[model samples]
Target: MEINKFIDHTILKATATEADIIELCKEAREYEFFSVCVNSGYVPLAKKQLSNSKVKVCAVVGFPLGAMSTEAKVFEAEQALKDGAEEIDMVINIGELKSKNLKKVEDEIAAIKNVIGDKVLKVIIETCYLTPQEIVIASELAVNAKADYVKTSTGFGTDGAKMENIKLMKKAVNGSAKIKASGGIKNLDTALSYIEAGVERIGTSSGVSIVKELKG
Candidate 1:
């Protein structure tokens, strides 16, 4: 498999600097990653840096915490698209889901997807914080909301993607939406494993290293 095409090279830390984003875009272009995922604040920088390259710029909305209001997330997603983001990886309203407020979760996701239009929207359910049943529920909600992908984690949560969670997510979506397995996927083997398990995208900061390992 051409793993680079499946990888979304990511750097979402609060302290990620301009130089960091520049290097990220540079590496993404050189490595030919599917996209360079970054914070909304760096969307314009990444867009400018990767303008001449095929590497797309992906921005995060609601980020590690999906506690923001739907209107706020919609505004953030809209601004990101205007700033040149081609894809959005948004965190789900975990609190609402846990509280059994399915409508809130579904509406929030649908609201963001509604604004993004044809652009990709990957809803992050932050699987580590939820039970297996919650993971299934969130995945189903993403499918109903018309999200492009159901993502496993934010890479800032208690844990990253797990194979079991990916399996559950895939089954829940039932091909209605694609799958993105992010967080703690740090090696070529792990990345391939997720692909074999039916995930369509892999979000990780270890893209360069994983590709290097593949080359070796």
Candidate 2:
């Protein structure tokens, strides 16, 4: 398999600077990753840097915390698109999900998806805080919301991605939605295992090492 196609080369830290983003984009192009996932503020830079490539630009909205109002998330989505974001990975309203406010969670995701229209939308379930049942419910809601992918974690969370959780997510999504196992996927063995389990994309800052590991 082509490792480049399955990667969303990511750099979401608050400290990531302009030069860092430019370098990230350059590496993404060099590696031919599917996309470069960055903070919304870096969307334009990433777009500019990757303009000559087929690689897409992905921006995160309502990021690690999914507590922002629906309007805010919609605005963020619209703005990201305007700034040249081809895909948006948004955090679901985790608080609402935890509180058993199913509609709120669903509406939050749907609103962002509506704003993005045909563009890709990957909902970050932030599995570290959720139970198995919650993960299933979130996966169902993401499918209902018309999301293109249901991603595992927002790397900034208490814990990163986990294989068991990814397995559960894949089963819950049931092939209706694609799966992106993000966060701490560090090496070739782990990445390949996730792919074997049906994960379509992998979001990681360790993309370089993983690729080298896979080929080494």
Candidate 3:
């Protein structure tokens, strides 16, 4: 199924040097991945490297933790776009949802979506933190809030995306939102399996490895 197009080559380490991101963009260019997902700070550099390539630039917002205020998230998203990011994968506020403050959660996402209009927004629910019901709720909220995609994890959390979670997300979303399963997907088997389970996008640092696995 042309797995490279499904992959979003990721490198989100706090200690990642500029050379690291440059190497990442080179790998993405070589592999022809759909995009290179990086921190907002690296968007311009990655953009420079990926110039004239079909590969897109995706930046994370509110990142590993979704506890930031809506204003903060919007500002981060704006800065990322200004830095040449074409897509955004934002983490939803889990604590707010768990606390029955769903309005706050929805409004936050909606606000970001409004500001970033037509620029893809992948809402990271961080599946590991939510119950099955919460997953469904989050999916519905994301869909209703007009998010383009409902994603799985942040890779910094306890666990990465699971097939079961993807399946649940697929059913919960009911085609209203696309699914992007991120984190811990290290091999071809898991990557393909997530696609089989209805993930439209994949977020992982192991993009090249998985493609090699696919070649095998």
Candidate 4:
């Protein structure tokens, strides 16, 4: 397999600077990875830097913490698209989901998807904060809301994606939507394991290393 194509080369740290994003785009182009994932604020810069290449730009909304209001996340997702983000990775409201406010959680996801229509929407369910049952519920909710992908974690969470969770998500989506395993995936073996388990995308800061390892 061309592992690089399955990777979303990412740098979402708060401390990530302009230089960092530039380097990210450069590496993405060099490696021919699928896309460069960045904060919404850097979407324009990333878009500009990657203008000449095939590497798409992905922006994160609601980020590590999914406590923001739905309107806020929608605006962020919209602006990111205007700024040239080809895909949006949004975090779902964990608090609302835990509170059993399933409609609110699903509506929030739908609100963003409505605006981004046709642009890929990947809902970050932050699997670390949820139970096995909650993981299944959250995955189903994203699919119900028409999200293109149900993502595992934010990497800022206490834990990241696990094989068991992937299994749960796969069964949860039930072929309605795809899965993206992010956070803590840092090596060729771990990435390939998720792919072997049927994840369509891999989000990580170690894309270059993983691709290099594959080449070796």
Candidate 5:
């Protein structure tokens, strides 16, 4: 199934160093994974490292926490794209969503998408913090905001992606947008399971091992 193409080689830890990103790009180039996901600050370095390769650069905005102001998220996304990020994975404001501020949640996503026009926008709904109904709501909100993908979690959350959540998201998006299952996906079996459930992307730090497992 060309599983490597479905993977987004990721390293978003706060403790990640220059060497770590370099090695990440190196591995991404070697393994020929789809893209390398990093913090906005590392977009330039990742872009530089990945130059001349087909592997794209994806930058995270609002990161593991989506509490930042929408303007802040927009600026982060703009700067990441200016620095060569080909795709943006943004976290939605969980607090606002829980407050039932649906407009705010949808507006925040739409605002970011407005700036990144045509550059891929994947909304990270941080599924761990939401209820089943909330997951569906967030997924629909992402679709309403015209996001390219609806992502499950941030991995830093208390929990990660689950099959039930994937099904909910699938029904929620209704094919208006694609789905990305991130967090806690660390093996070939788990990744394959998500793909089997219809996720278009797999965001994980275990892309190396997962691809190796598939190759072997």
Candidate 6:
């Protein structure tokens, strides 16, 4: 399969520089990745670098920690879109979800979606921090909130996406939304395994390496 299309070439490290984002867009164009995921601060640069390319600019909202207020997340998402982000990967309020405040979690996602309109919204459930039941509940909440995808991990969590979590997310979304398996997808085999497990997207910093492996 042409796996590059399924990849969201990502670089979300705390120390990422402007040069790093430029190179990311360059590599994304070269590899024809589906998108280049970056921090919100670099959205304009990524958008400029990728202006004439099919590779989209995706911005992360609430980032590694989703403890921010819903207003903050919504504003972040709206500004990212204005800065030219075509897709948004937002972290949910994990604390609320754990507290069984499902409505709060659902409203937070819905509020951001309301501002973005037709722009794509991917909810990062950070599966590593959740139990099986929590994963299911989060997935359902995302679906109900009109999220386009239920993403696994932040790649900043204790662990990234696992096959088991992918399966659970898939069953939970039940076709209500797509699945994006990020974190720990370092090679071709693991990437494909997530796809086979029903993930429609792969978020990783190793997209170039994975494609190189595919070529070899």
Please write out the lDDT profile of model 5 over residues 87-187, one tens digit for every residue.
Answer: 99999999999999999999999999999999999999998899999999999999999999999999999999999999999999999999999999999
**TM-score for each predicted model, relative to the true structure:** 0.99, 0.98, 0.98, 0.99, 0.99, 0.99
Which residue runs does candidate 2 get wrong by more than 4 Å?
Answer: none
Say which prediction, candidate 1 or candidate 3, comes out ahead on TM-score: 1
User: What's the CA RMSD for each of the models?
Assistant: 0.6, 0.8, 0.8, 0.5, 0.5, 0.6
lDDT of 6 by residue, 36-141 (tens): 9999999999999998899999999999899999989999999999999999999999999999999999999999999999999999999989999999999999
| Cα displacement (Å) at residue 54, model 1 | 0.7
Better candidate by lDDT, 1 or 3: 1
- The alpha-carbon lDDT assigned to residue 173 of candidate 4 equals 99
lDDT for each residue of candidate 1 in 5-98, tens digit (9 for 90 to 100): 9999999998999999999999999999999999999999999999889999999999889998899999999999999999999999899999
For model 3, where is the 10-residue window of minimal lDDT?
A: 190-199
lDDT for each candidate structure: 0.95, 0.92, 0.93, 0.96, 0.97, 0.95
Which runs of model 1 end up more than 4 angstroms from their true locations? none
Off by over 4 Å in 3: none
lDDT of 6 at 153: 92
Q: Please list the residue runs of candidate 6 whose C-alpha ends up more than 4 Å from where it truly belongs after superposition.
A: none
